[model samples]
Target: MPEVGVTYFAGTFVRHPLTMAVVHAALRHMRANPGLQEQVNTTAERLVDRLHALLAAEGFPMHIGRFGSLLKPEWTQEPAFGELFYYYLREAGVYAWDARPNYLTTAHGDTELDRIVEGFEYAVGQMKRGGFLDDVRPTAQLVTLASDRTSITVPSTESQREVWLADRFVAGNSLAYNEGLLLTLDGALDEDALRHALQTLLDRHESLRARFSRDGRRLVIDHHLELDLPVHDLSGLGEAERTAALERLCDEEMGRTFDLRRGPLIRFALARLDERRHRLLFIAHHAVCDGWSGAVLLTELGAVYSARVTGRAAELDPAPRYADYVAVERHFLESPVGQAHREYWLKQLHDAPQPPQLPPDRSPGPDPGLSAARVDVPVDAELVTRLRALGSAHGASLVATMLTGFAELFRRCTGQDDLVIGLAAAGQSFHGQGQLVGHCVNLLPLRLRLDTADGFADALAITRTALLDAYDHQGVSFGTLLPELELTPRRQSAAAGERRVQHRRARRRHRPRRSGCRLPHAGAAGRDLRVVHQRGRHRHVDGAGGQLPHRAVQRGAHPRLPGGLPRPAARRLRR
Candidate 1:
């Protein structure tokens, strides 16, 4: 038998009444709201008028056309204007297609119109400043969409490539790229509900089901993979026995290595402490997860578990897929935007000085190069608030404020005025990537010069500017950036110069969003939040070693603590 022709079979599928019915309803609604069209047209005209003024002021040969509420913008002479303008608009908080027609609706108000005009101005100004207007840069390139749900294979992201390199670096330790989180639950546990929650999580996040090929050249994601939660019931044992067993389990899980070629990069184990307490442990390969993903996992797991136990449907927004992120990154590297970013980074790090060599606390050893010690200092909530205020006064974030303190201390330690420090970023500043679960993090080099005449406020301002600039151009990955800059990070083979301690601040200022699940605190289930201990690690490794040590400063503690020293001790040292 012969199969139906493509046109004949496809024609029937378009005759569905549901689409027509929706269109009819929309038309009816529009008829009822007779002023909708007028409002949209008015808004569009206002936008066009603003753009025309901006174009005339900037003296650019750009054309703007409008029919009713639909508007189109184009450059008559320069082909790169569209691409450069689109990116600049995006940077100015306006997301638009590459020189495509823009439609305005009744929903758009004056505020949005103002923002659009401002964005246009900013884009034009940037294009002029970048010398793009003077010379035609590369035209924008199109990116392929991974819409085929059957299977996806794309080149690994910069973050994933870095992880792969580190995994190879620490060849003996397979668990070098593992990230784990332990959540202590105090309630009547539900094993069935937990299992369902785990399944839902795995189904929602594609990164958890990701696997790299043996050659480590490509990342392959398997859409169909069933994962079971391994439960270890330690409730039968005595408190002491259960505690010891749990500790051993933590070590084992931490030490367990994943086979990147096989599959199942994430592991979940439930240990029931007793009738009222339980410990949930989740370990995932760093290739598949990051610091931000941990919070996402916890939030979603909590929501699903609560809904399943309570016999209600889980309410979750569809997660942004990792595949989309990979495709976008690939497109970026191949586009003019990527080239611009490369230029910016190169200029920023031109003739950059090497990091000062700090003396290691201990001598060299034959053991593997990655060794670190963790220290926890419990910071008072009041002091945290004060620190935040201090940062605000300097027009910076808490992290930036803390970074200033860290840089100053390092300068004092090494007695170096010029320094380059690696700052960790979540790398999710894109519109759809905030909730993505994957290795999308990027490390940016923060270079600062401190002089004896510089004060605290000067340092803070410099740090804030450097941090903000880094974030603005953080689209390019460090792995890709290093090669472009023609630089190689020194290896830390038990060498003091290769060892540097970076401070990673893990601050949870806000509680989880409103869900049925209760927040777990140290003492009670839902009392006011309290930071039990601020922990940080000190490690000596290469900049791209993939392992970041953390240290925290507890109130009233000695200045020599990890994470950070006490404020008084730091001040004393400064004096």
Candidate 2:
């Protein structure tokens, strides 16, 4: 049986005393409409029942009951809450409840209460003015799975809280910005032309105006808007100062959250660097954009900027909008394409091993609790020249050569003949659509199993083949693959009998560093060597207590060139 508990608010749920009066006034008006009252009653009942079931199934120690503005709670005696909670989640929209034990008795001072009432009144007014509830739903796509046992459980209250907080934080911090290398031109560019180009880009991408709201606890997106991209002038600051300002603007833009009661969740900022050089920063929440989307924006902006600078009309074609991609994705997921991919994954991972057994740590927190350390294996200029020569000799790209080096690194690190590392591919393959911004990238996990005697050239051949295969099958989304692979979370069993399968399953494989991992890139200009350090932290579940490997190393001169390599200065000047 599920436990039951009460939820308390710091004060009356209505916020201000006047707000309660307004609410009472609204309620009296609402009472005159029998149909509206009926709908509200039904919604409330459904919500309560769903909450109860969620608590019971998740084995939440408490159940919530509302009396007037106060919620009553009860504690659970059952052990397995995850199964039931997830079941409730799928059946209904409830993801979480306020878990703070003393919620009801908390005191909200007068100032806070006033703000809450004002917000409520504003929200109610909007709702009455044909503001649909769907407009306020969150825009999170539901990640589905195939096997029942594949569901990963949020093991504790803390874990659940962390997920909630992470979602909220991510939503709150999204911006209309694209992460790209900003280049400052030495000459003035046409601002009006630039604005026109930007507006065209915004109109072309549906993600630029995607709105988010909550569908129960899950986030749902409604792509709506024909928005104009705002442009500003910042051509009067030093280069360093301009970069600093752009970075700050990016941070600020990414940190905004949408309020349903407020008008729109869009923001833009521009910074000036000097008389001729200027920087443009665009930010949008992940609710509307992804990494691949950023690439598309940069590619388009480059083209548009170039066109304007050259005084040539932009020669870009009218490509499909992001909504088209979503429609195509939905169709693909439901059609033969999705099925074939699912079958492929099913066979590949049919006898796959369990997740890697990471080393344990003692951390008492709700953060992903994962950390990472990176090392750059810099190839000498000569070696780079040699590698380029070798690639040209073998008809391979620089990317292929890099893959070979990575495979070698993994082979040495894991001591395994067969290795696989997931690579994120920029999804810009759509014809006449490389520049359209949206979440078009997918992480393709490539397997590289090299024979111990294999040379770099042989490994490169295999890497090339694997990458091509991934590109061929890039139509399927990871959201669809997770389910068919039966990669759901498993419960930690206390009984010894349950340990056998778990231990056996655990020994079978290795996983990569957590998501958002990036490699450091080094570049050289004139007499100075510039190394760009990309910092990334891993996201782990709460109570997992996992520590990623960390190391600190000193920077040193570039290794000696392999052979016949031009000096760094000549190379820079040539570029």
Candidate 3:
């Protein structure tokens, strides 16, 4: 409400510079077509026609969009929006503050308009419910976040530090390290209830609320006062349209990178496939959440959503904060055990052979940049069963057998019996660490030496031993051990610091797209390997960005790439 007798009540009124231009343009259009004026019943009708005509002038929308209210030092903060009345926002209790004019920028459109309209409707509903319409009347405002900043700083966990380094190395590639999860609700969902549940989940996890800022090399994390969790409804979309739109949304979400600082590192959306089906999406920056953290998130969301739909208190247990892991990691790094592990790693890698590169597909590219491509090769279900039995017969594990097969592909490619490939492991082996949200991944370089004379069974044993030994010394992060490893002559010294997350899968190798494993750009040899264990069949795909070795191509039993490159396949898949 405007103050009737207020003195020193500071406020600002901004005039749109283009108001007269539009009025003049409308009048000119009217004059140019006298017939239009003759058709109008009255002067008011003619003016309305002239007004619509003037709206076509270039930059006119932008000029009108600039209208906003400025305030004195006493307000100190920008209200919910540039032009919204401050008193109304205060009456409705919408949180907002800013020093800027909050201009409705040229980019603002239906998204901005809808958000403001929703806030207004919500405020009116509140007024009617509280019998306040007869009292101080509420006015329109826009949905927005509270602007109060929360001061929070956290120590980086060993895993977090590793991720930070990798994040920096591959800077500006958004979605480069994002984790995407798609869930389908096969029943009708209550939109209001689901939004409540999602908000509860966001509030439940501190990591979800966390934002990171780099203070030089050190990473700092802080919280936001209130987060805006907007829910989108696309339930009315036709099945085909919904599918296409959702695919585009997934790609857009997965590919957009996050600023670890200035964070809203996670995002979500919902599409109603029909009255009976709804799909939910969760995309989170890897710095704060990992695969394990996602599992935890789902578990909690399920409880929250269930209780909400049925009108019960969620009553979820307190979640472990990422900070907790940072504290544990700091102590571990300072302990004698940590030092011993580091020493063991250094000694282990002291005389380690350089990583073997897979033979290139073509001669080479003049440019030394990386490119990624994905292909799936079906494995024979029966062959997979036989391979498992073969492992059992040789007293070796199935994974060991698979690695042995992969090594054969390597041997065939390079005509060398000895090679080392990195495999991934979840490093949350300690007590109370299972539920923490943060990076807890470790990459292990498993070296295998197979004699051409030995049977496949014998090679499996060696691979198993290498894998088990690496498991025993899993505390040292791949980042922690990088300085101690020998590198091939072709490898750049600076590139040694490049932390390729080197995950072992994508048949979707059969690794989630957000696994963040870069397909090995063709180099001194094949750079990495991916194994897809699906059904009874196992397909070994190269992260090395090239064609398979000639002999391996000839040796493959089923499916081939377009150019006749052999795809590893088996007949049997097993437990």
Best by TM-score: 1
Q: Can you rank all candidates by TM-score, best first?
A: 1, 3, 2
Model 3 scores a TM of 0.62
Which of candidates 1 and 3 reaches a greater TM-score? 1
Q: Write the per-residue lDDT of candidate 2 for residues 26-80, one digit (tens) a residue.
A: 6687677756545544443343354444433332333344332333232222122
Between candidates 2 and 3, the one scoring higher on TM-score is 3
Q: CA lDDT of 154 in candidate 2? A: 12
lDDT of each: 0.64, 0.41, 0.52
Q: Whole-model lDDT for model 3 versus the true structure?
A: 0.52
Residue pairs in clash, model 1: 499-540, 536-550, 536-551, 537-550, 537-551, 551-563, 552-563
Report the lDDT tens digits of candidate 1 across residue range 405-489: 7777666656677777766677655435777788887766667777742677888888888888877777776567565564435
Give per-residue CA lDDT, model 3, range 1-575, as digits (tens): 33465343223443344555666777788788776533432322322223223322211111011112211111112223323333344455533342222323223345544554454445434434554433332222111212222233555555566666556664333334666777767767787777777787676666776655443233334334244544456667877887788776666656666766656678876766678776777777776776667766676677788898888998876766666766676677678887876776677666555444445456545443333333445767665666667778878866776667667655665566766567666655543466566566666666566764376657777888877877776666766776566655543332242212133532232233332222211121213334444445344343332333332334533344212334453332110
Better of 1 and 2 by lDDT: 1
C-alpha RMSD values across all candidates: 20.4, 18.0, 20.1
